[model samples]
Target chain A: MSTRWLAQPERGNRRLIRLLTWITLKLGRPVARWLLYPICLYFLLFSGRTQRISREYLQRILKRPAGWRDVFRHYHAFASTIHDRVYLLSGRHRYFDIRIEGASALHAILAQKRGCILLGSHLGSFEVLRAHGLFDQQLPITVIMHEAAASNLNAVLHSLHPEIRDHIIPPGTPDTMLAVKERLDQGEMVGILGDRVFGDEKGMTCDFLGKPRMFPEGPFLLAALLQVPVVLFFGLYQGGRQYDIHFEPLADSIHLDRVRRSETLRPWIERYVSRLEHYCRLYPYNWFNFYDLTDDARPSHTAV
Target chain B: MASSPQLGFTTASGLEQDLAKLIVDSLRLEVAPGDIDPAAPLFGDGLGLDSIDMLEIALAVSKRYAVELRSENRAALASLRALAAHIAQQRTS
Candidate 1:
């Protein structure tokens, strides 16, 4: 799979990011959000690659040619989520109308004291879920991520809420799986974004949004190894201070036979991609992967 | 410690050899089992293994020896010899 996404540089520098953060915190959200319009306009005019990608993705999912306004709205949705992160991280969730669906099912799984994997994508705001973990039921959610992917942005965001640093588990470290296993053993929820492929990790190509897209196999492999239930979550930005967090049960346990590893994993990935597609169609503007997902040169392998 | 009846002369002990083979097989490493240094690190520069390999080794060890490896016991993953000792100690305990 193409690793182009990894090489994509952070747009703004640290000084600019810190300045924005400072403004967002000092001026309050209402005054701070006005800054996004100019910022979005700057990106739309200057970031040719991202703008083209946004247009293409919107067209594919919308089933119609995306005009400049559609692309602008897409960028605005993304910027809104990023802006909300400051409030969510600073414990100001009351400012927004956050509605949660299928939360009772999640509570039931947690009540069993057997931790499950909360698999998410780049669809919407993950910070909303973090807010839920922080204020709501006090759900112990640890995020597994590739830290080096967006170091500049992360550095700025981490500074906003220093406490969140403790909750992140970067993959590829020797202690990564052990840490994840320990957390699961303690009945703590582990959150992983399974849409993007990183490094040389194996990826399985599945039909998504009318084309084959490669998804990292590492998350599913970890789930199979840990023998835990898997749950799907999507924190969709419903525009104008409204965020809908949805959770659904995915698998009781993913068992991959050694002989038929890819075959067993196929259905799981397909189910995930289909659910992601359903949501993307439902809320077309909420998709946040800013790169060409279906442009992989790797030959698609059918399950044996 | 000198020799084993099942296999011919070998430098590593039976447990260490078993663990080494398990590591090579599970990770599908091109190196031979005997080539791996028992005292060298299993991850990073030594074996060039990553977190995924660690989990793969852990799964293999649990299935073969029925000993569970935990994050708290990170020292056990220091080297092949250390891992073998940890497994033997756990099995006995």
Candidate 2:
């Protein structure tokens, strides 16, 4: 059970990503999106791991035997989200019709003059949230990411639009906490992907879907220490040029005492996992953790 | 800038030792306070700690020193020497 998502080889290179970006911008979305079918087919035929993982995820979410078509749809959804990123990155959000659910809750949070942790997952287009940032000047958003994975593609994306690169806070660096803290101090939004744990990072086993899966303790711990409000953001790919951006408040404030910090944090994590599961049901093809998430046999103690 | 110099205990080595003890007790590590190298990394290969441990240390520091260590304090968190210095400088007590 390879729980490590970062260890997996990058699917596309810098050249491919740049080419897709160029073609998408030059040819426009509709024609560029037609290219996703062949790309999805390429993965469906060649990437056996992606196919099997897609089936595994689809089976659990769909609650039925997932067939090749379902897997294809899953791949297509992922590819489409990636394609939309080209537009989103370039500040061309007019192409997609994004309906933001819970805008009131978001506005209310922003009303309070405190920074927040925008906990996002890989379920949908995170770029969609950034797209919202482009239009809305009030919501200053920054993403916390592991820059090592897909360095080449990230470099390409950064080169295309340096503003996107400016908003990134890479984890594990000495300045990561400083960057997060500085942004939060300015009453700005700091986004972090709560789904995937990196190599040797401490994680906690929680009931996700129906089985126990390891969820990284880092993000939750950061929230707890900072004692800030946390909001769950999910941008689901509805299909074609439509998306649903959902924002729900996960916690008013995360405070874990030293005595039973682990015990206290467990419920908060479970609630988050349950919400993620609920969203996965709504958009069955959106959940994209490609690793063996159901592998409960991995010793829980290995996290630290 | 560390402004809390009124506590009067100004020895850097002494503060480092105190922080080492605090870390061990807070994280429940098996190592003795003296065993922790002041210059060694608190994360990854040195102490083999993760974000949770770091947060634990932060919480403990906050409670003990009445200092809220924000993310901007990350540079000062890299080693025990640095963290101890930051805590001493920031400690309201």
Question: TM-score for each prediction?
Answer: 0.86, 0.87
Point out where model 1 deviates above 4 Å.
A1-11, A146-150, A297-304, B1-12, B24-32, B35-50, B63-68, B72-82, B85-93
lDDT of 2 by residue, A26-87 (tens): 99998988998887777777777667778888898889999999998988887787778778
lDDT of 1 by residue, A1-304 (tens): 1112112324346677778889999999889999989877776677777778788889898889999899889988988888888788888888899899988999899888889899999899888998779766578898986452356666777677787877788776677888888888899999988787765567888887878888877778888978888999999999988999999999888998876787888889889998999999998999887757666643221100
Candidate 2 collision pairs:
none
Pairs with backbone N, CA or C atoms under 3 Å apart (clashes), candidate 1? none
User: Quick one: best TM-score, which candidate?
Assistant: 2
lDDT for B30 in candidate 2 is 92
True contacts kept of each: 0.56, 0.26
User: What does the lDDT read for residue A40 in candidate 2?
Assistant: 76
